[model samples]
Target chain A: MNDMVKLEKVVKVYGHGATEVQALRGVDLALEAGEFTVVMGPSGSGKTTLLNIIGSLDRPTRGRVLIDGEDTTRLSASSLSRLRLTRIGFVFQAYNLIPVLTAYENAEYVLMLQGRRPDERREKIMGLLRTVGLEGMENRFPRELSGGQQQRVAIARAIASEPELVLADEPTANLDSGTAASLLDLMAQLNEEKGATFLFSTHDPQVMRRARRTIVLHDGEIAADRHGPAGDE
Target chain B: MIVRLAWRSLWRYRRRTSITVSAIAVGTALAVFFVTMADGMYKKLIDEAVRMGAGYVTVEHPDYSRDLSIGLVVTGISSVIDEARRIPGVTGIKVLIQGQAVISTAGGSAGVGIFGIDPETERTVSPLADRIVDGRYLEGADERGVIVGASLAERLKLRPGKKLVLTTNDANGELVNEMLRVTGIFRMGMEEADGFLVQVPLDTARRIFGIGPDAATRVGLVLASPRDQSRVLEDLRRRLAGTEAAVLPWQAVMPDLAGFMAVDKGFNYVFQMIIMVIIGFTILNTILMSVLERTREFATLMAIGTSPLRLRLQVAVESLFLGATGTVLGLLLGGALSWYFQVHGIDFSGIYSDDTTIVGYAIDPLIKNHVTAGAFLLVGAFVLALTLVIGLYPSWRAARISLPDVLRSR
Candidate 1:
């Protein structure tokens, strides 16, 4: 399989002098295209930092990050933004949908950023919303929806632009157990049917059990990388 | 879509948005009221000053205003008056013989200005004929009577029919004196006129000042519309070319009133600036608070691939909506207030004396506001521009927030 993202000796340092923190310490990893992977770690183990560096949301202190074969470390801030817009999608732990926009607008945001035609944007966004089980709730704002529903809208937004990689950082952290299981099922279905690559960070055993590959992180370093059955199906 | 987003964002904090809009509206309304009142007050002052003695246009010898000497009289006065009366906007022309003199009665003596006017023609040029409070105005054939201002009469302890002696140097440089009976006492609410000016018949003044029948110090032309002064002056200047007289509009004749107008305009601008600054700060505070409160949301937008520039533009659009909404409301409220004042007027007699004068010209205590399209345009532009300028700081702050830091906080 072709590589979708590559990271070599990536180190991220926070603060300065005596208050410094080594969030990522010389971590090296690669994610293959079409892989349903999970990064599992305890709190402050640099799972989110690593995802940020790979997604071009943060600069590494010392390392090289490549996405779709282009070195993102050498890109300007504007170019990094362009890279994120065209090649990557992000789903945050809090399901950060814009509060003012309705479910349909939130889901269609990335497509709008891509400047797709209005009819195409509406069709693709509606299809994704339906796939994520939000078919009849298109006009409801984020405030009017449940935690599970908002997360589904966020997921639809992430895949609407057809990015090469989708990074979900504890997307189900705020949902109840049953909603979390349902959301995971929908994401897994999208991965299998559309050949979409998804890398999620979680410490939940339920999530790790469902992923085809699992990488464990300890103290800002990767401890083990293993493969298992794609268990949800 | 961006516009829709921006508009929707404003209503998210409904109370805050309404408060900001109200602040701008109140500020703009106050500005409109003050600007209109000041404009109307100044116009009233000018009208009163012109109607007091200085007609819309004045004709005099080149040095008459500065010297006021009887020797500086305009020759061939009847011809100049005839020419002036022919000008289209010129409604009436009257000859005036003005000179400084000393007036004495049994009780007092004071230096005063003497105006020699043709009562019949002066009636058409000035309101002095209608302002006689006691006794009768001068008549064309009555050459022995004079009208003294009320203050002058009180100071001299004289009444109508009392004899007063006036002394002045005539055109031949000889001191001439005349005993004249006071026919009327007039009060025009002006200190200069009520205290020190006396008007006599034109023939009586000619005899006392030793000037010829067709000679006078100046000619005052009255116009139907004061706005037509310039055109009539231009016509008079052309017609009276080669004569010994010079023609001047009232603004040239009364520099103090003209200068007051300029100063009043400057005061209006300064007042407007102060109001705008206050409203600008309110807008700045509101928008900055909004940015601070939505830091995480902004970061999420940036992570989702919105450029910093576009985010700033969205904030700017929000500010524009607030400014436009407030300006329209303020204009409506202010227009209603101005229209009410124009009809009923604001009575200042309770706050100030009824005889209050500004820069030597009497003004009515009751004032009505005058609104102009330019005032509305200026106030609207100022508020809109101020809101937009104030929006930039919050927009910049939003653009500069680090997405990673914000998300990590969440």
Candidate 2:
């Protein structure tokens, strides 16, 4: 499989002088297309920093990131935004659906930004909503939905454009264990059905257990990389 | 989708948006109403000044304007009048011989400004003909008959048919005297006009002053509309290029009135600009707060693949929507108020006396509104443009928000 995301000796530092803190240190990673991977770490281990650098939402202080064979570190901010729009999708821990938009609109937002036709956006969003078990709840706003349902809508939004790389930062952090399990089941089903790659950062053990490949981050560096029994590469 | 998002986001803070919109609406309404009313009042003052003395456009000896000398008179008067009458905007014309003269009754004598006018033509243009409080207006055949202001006749202790002697110099600088009967009395509502002005028949003045029938000090051209003054002045100047006639507009003849209106209009515009700035600040505060409170949401949008430029565009669109809505509402309200006042004027009789004058032209106590379509559109466009300008800082701030910091904090 082709590599969907590649990070080469990445380092990210916040502030300077006495206030300086390193978020990531010389981390090298590759995520292949169609893989369900999780990067597990405690808070301050730079899980979100890695996700951000890989998503093109933030630039690394050192080294380079490649998404879909394009050098993101060399791209301008506008160009990086275009790369993210076309090649990447993100699911946040808080299920950051636009509150003013309905569930269907939230799912359709990326497609609209891609300048797709209305008919195509509607078809894709409706199918994704059904697949995520949010079919009847399409017209409801994020505030009206429960946390599990909002997270389902967020998952639908992430994969709506069929992006090559999907990044989820602690997707199940805010959900109960049962809801988290079902959400992981939904993500796995989508990964298998749609062949879309996903990289997750989480402290949830269930996510780590379900992950086909798990990379453990400790103190701003990778401690170990493992493949669980469920699916191994 | 951007517009939809902008519109929905505006309603997210319904109370704030409503308050901002209301402030803009009220400011715009007051601006429109006061601007139209002032336009009407100034129009009334200009018309009163021009029609009563020099017409909207005047023709006289080029040197007569500086000296006001009876010796410097416009010759070939019939041809000048005929040529002026052919001009497009020239609605009427009047020939007059104007000079200062001493009028003596049996009891006393006083100096006054005397005008020798074609009584027939003056009836159509001058309000003096219609303001005869007592007695009748002069006739073309009454060569010795004259119209005197009520205040002048009262001061002289005279009545209609009473004889008085006018003493002045003829065109040759020779002292001359003519006896005139008071044919009419007029109350012009201005102290300057009612106390110091007198009009006599044109032939009688020519005979008394020893001037030829073709000689006159001034020929005034009345126009159908005030806007036609400049074009008519230009045409008359071109037509009478070599006649040594100074074709002047009313503003040239009435500098005090012109200056007063200029200062008055300047103050009005400054006042209106202050109102717009206040409205602009209200819009700025609301939009700035909205952007500030939604920092996390904007960062989320950027992280999810929406460009910073697009986020800024959405915020601008929101401001534009707010401005357009308020401007439209204000125009409706202002138009209704203006229309009502245009038809039924606002009475200022309680506020101002009837004889209140701006540079000696009486102001009518009732003021109407006169808003042209162009003026209305200009005000609306100005407000909309100002709103857009005031929105720029907040949009820039929105685009400059740090995505990583905001998302990490959330």
lDDT (Cα, tens digit) per residue for candidate 2, span B146-165: 88888889999877889999
lDDT, each prediction: 0.86, 0.88
In Å, residue B102's CA in model 1 sits off its true spot by: 3.1
lDDT of 2 at B61: 88
Write candidate 1's Cα lDDT for A119-187 as tens digits: 999999888888778889999999999988898889888888878789999987777788678778877
Candidate 1 lDDT over B206-317, as tens digits, reads 9988989988887888787766888999998999888878899887888887887888789888988898898998899988999999988888888988888888999999
Look at candidate 2 and tell me the lDDT of residue B129: 96
Misplaced by over 4 Å in model 2 are A16-18, A174-195, A229-233, B75-89, B210-215, B241-243
Clashes of each: 0, 0
Q: Candidate 1: which stretches are off by over 4 Å?
A: A1-3, A32-35, A174-197, A204-213, A225-233, B53-97, B104-108, B116-130, B136-146, B158-166, B170-183, B200-252, B258-274
Candidate 1's displacement at residue B20, Å, is 1.6
Per-model TM-score on C-alpha atoms: 0.85, 0.93
lDDT (0-100) at residue A233 of candidate 1? 26
TM-score of chain B of each: 0.83, 0.94
